[model samples]
Target: MEQAELPSPPSPARLPWDFHPALTEERLRLCGRMLANARRDALAMARYEMGDDPWSVGCRAFAFGRNRLQRAASSGDYPWLEVLDDSAHFVFVIGGNGNGVPVRFYRGAADEPTERTLRRQEMEVQQLSLALGETEAEGLAFRLAVET
Candidate 1:
């Protein structure tokens, strides 16, 4: 008799951490629409991270858990999406509002952001995203995280 092999586990998301908000079809579609409208396609990256507290349950609780990390058992299940820009200067975050994660833009400073500063900022943002539970997104955007 031949022995059968067991199935291997799934692969987690290629992101820094596992976030619950899911990056689902609906959310992705809405986010794509928002970006297209805002003319913010000059983006570099997007990240979906786990969050602690969620302001509104809404449609957010239902993320399709695309990646393996996302599919794993999570302590909390709130999704936060964040997007970074081409220059690596501005960070546009979108985590809430119905099924659509609205975009909010932020500029680091007048001077160019250093790698250390960017890493620090990214860590800070990740922490916040974990607590808040509804957002972060990316690209030429997530180079800070991807490259370094």
Candidate 2:
């Protein structure tokens, strides 16, 4: 008798709502630990060191995005910036091969918003930025659609 294959479990994006970059090395170490603990079948995982050459990071982001169900990922001059997607935001860490490679993470996405999407994740971007060490003063002020 042939057995049926199990469907993949729902992979909800897991945002690091409480991250804070301590010592730069410490931050990467923590990211590596997180990556080690992330779901084995994560949709994307890429390195994102601050100040890396944009082209290099973009290449890695492209590789990661290519594996996503939505095929979306990119970076500006800032490799350690953020990712954009349609519905939600998430972050994941990967690295720790002991070669001293700095860890990278899969920050969640933020795309054009809809009423429902805004209601759900309007403030998530801010929170994720904070978690990633954006100071209160550095956080961007987002005006609601009605306010703009």
lDDT of each: 0.33, 0.34
Candidate 2 has its poorest 10 consecutive residues by lDDT at 94-103
Candidate 1 per-residue lDDT, tens place, 81-103, comes to 54322232333333533332222
Count of clashes in candidate 2: 6
Candidate 2 lDDT over 83-102, as tens digits, reads 33333233222111211111
Model 1 ranges with Cα > 4 A deviation: 9-18, 22-27, 38-88, 96-120, 123-129, 132-148
What RMSD does each model have against the real structure? 17.4, 20.7
**Deviating ranges (above 4 Å) for candidate 2:** 1-23, 37-88, 91-104, 107-121, 128-148
> Top TM-score: which candidate number?
1
Clashing pairs in 2: 19-131, 35-93, 84-110, 85-109, 85-110, 90-108
Q: What would the TM-scores of all predictions be?
A: 0.27, 0.20
